[model samples]
Target: MILKRFFQRSQSPARSCYEAIVAAARHPRLYADWGVPDTLDGRFDMITLHTYLVLERLKGEEPEFRQAVVDEFFRDMDRSLREMGVGDLSVGKKVRKMAESFYGRIAAYDAALAAPGDGLAAALARNVFPDEEGGPDIAGVRRLAEFVLTQRARLAAQPVRAIAGGDVRFEEPGP
Candidate 1:
């Protein structure tokens, strides 16, 4: 239900892009941590507007806006990454990796939806559009979000241990 709620709040074109960026940043396994900026005003506003345009096109309402929004989104992402002190090489690599992974997942989900089944395929399909019949399934999305969040939480809660050779050394627990 939490994922459903999160997505519900995220479905607003005005907010979904920001939420997506936040979600990506929060992913525990991410390789970099640029830390939060002092303010999210301009960047957030740009992302929201760009995302809204993308959503409008996806919904077949304003198809012409997609390319412009996409261009603006990349420009904003690059600027934000630089402002956060992410090195040029690192930013480019990370962004490309993220984009590839994101697009791959989306494509896979779309393919799954085109198939005829009601199991994992159905679940994957649901992720692409979590609000329509045979489309997005809130319950499924919630399950996935919870699973990812739990993994992230576990990673965060883990104590840092030193590994030497083949062995790990951990600090003693407090009495």
Candidate 2:
């Protein structure tokens, strides 16, 4: 399967996986905890993870750290694709596309965050819904904030996967 090729070429999936998990967990927590509403569909955990991965890449960490984060991100994305019944090559391609899109969004978000004023909120709103206005709609902002918190929680929960893998596992709040 694709995992075989991915592992063979990449090698040491564990280290890479661990780094990705850490990177994904590094976003600002207040966003996720105070921002997202109780009622939304889809898991924000993945989005938060993607954000941290992008930030880490931007920071220009060592190659090993970068590769590990990328590998882990792809692995988790592939797992999500598989669960959705996507085929191997398709999953690989889609994961790449998703990563690119995610990176682009992260860059945009970082730029916004660096700027003065409440630009980050506007940038996030635009990123989340480009078709709409620049500022975050009520729900979109909430989701973004929630994602930040969730990412922090995920990282905190999973300090070490082999020892605490259960911590990173996504759990939806009760309706």
Candidate 3:
């Protein structure tokens, strides 16, 4: 079993892409300079956003590959919940809810991206900073929106072959 796990870990491009997504999401500037709350939900939102960007870029790729990447995401989420000491009985339910949240974010973000003006920023503010009183920090959310737009274009310009080979690259988020 250990050897099998090792082999899969070493061979999976999906794994590499998932890792890249997590690394990008964990960039400290996102939480510190960009005003994303340094909390579990905030982190999840960031990861979801990055995942959407990659998936969007992968739209015309093999269906199996896309599904594999998504499977990797859910597996990681399951592991995260387990590590957080969530009871086994509750983990599935929580993951289901998370999946719902992810899909919802994807839909919102996708539509907002095509919307005119501050639509994307508004969506990010609503989803990423949901806990903020009155409203999420508009300026911070706008900054994040700009980052997302830039990354989306960058991802689009990247060769699909490289991304399919798990060579995804994301620019550092900065102030």
Best TM-score goes to which candidate? 3
Clashing pairs in 1: 129-136, 130-136
Task: Tell me the tens digit of each residue's lDDT in model 3 across 89-139.
Answer: 999999999999999999998899777888898889889999998888888
Better candidate number, 1 or 2, judged by lDDT: 2
Tell me how far the alpha carbon of residue 114 in candidate 1 is from the true structure, in angstroms, after superposition. Answer: 2.3
Taking all chains together, each candidate's TM-score versus the true structure is 0.35, 0.51, 0.93
Model 2: residues with Cα > 4 Å off, grouped in runs: 1-60, 129-136, 139-175
Specify the poorest-scoring 10-residue window by lDDT in model 1: 162-171
Query: Which residue pairs come into collision in candidate 3?
Result: none
**Model 2, residue 133: C-alpha shift (Å):** 11
In angstroms, give how far residue 76 of model 1 lies from its true place. Answer: 3.6
| Cα misplacement distance, residue 105 of candidate 2 (Å) | 1.3
What TM-score does prediction 2 earn?
Answer: 0.51
Please provide, for model 2 over 1-175, each residue's C-alpha lDDT reduced to its tens digit, 9 standing for 90 to 100.
Answer: 9778867854464444455444444334423543332221123333533535343432543455445555665676678789989998798788778778667766766676567776655655555444434543666565554554454455445434332222233334222
Tens-place lDDT per residue, model 1, 1-175, is: 7677766632333233344434433333221221112134323422332243233224443343344335445665677789989998899886686456445554544444356554333443333333445544445444433433343344334332211011111121111
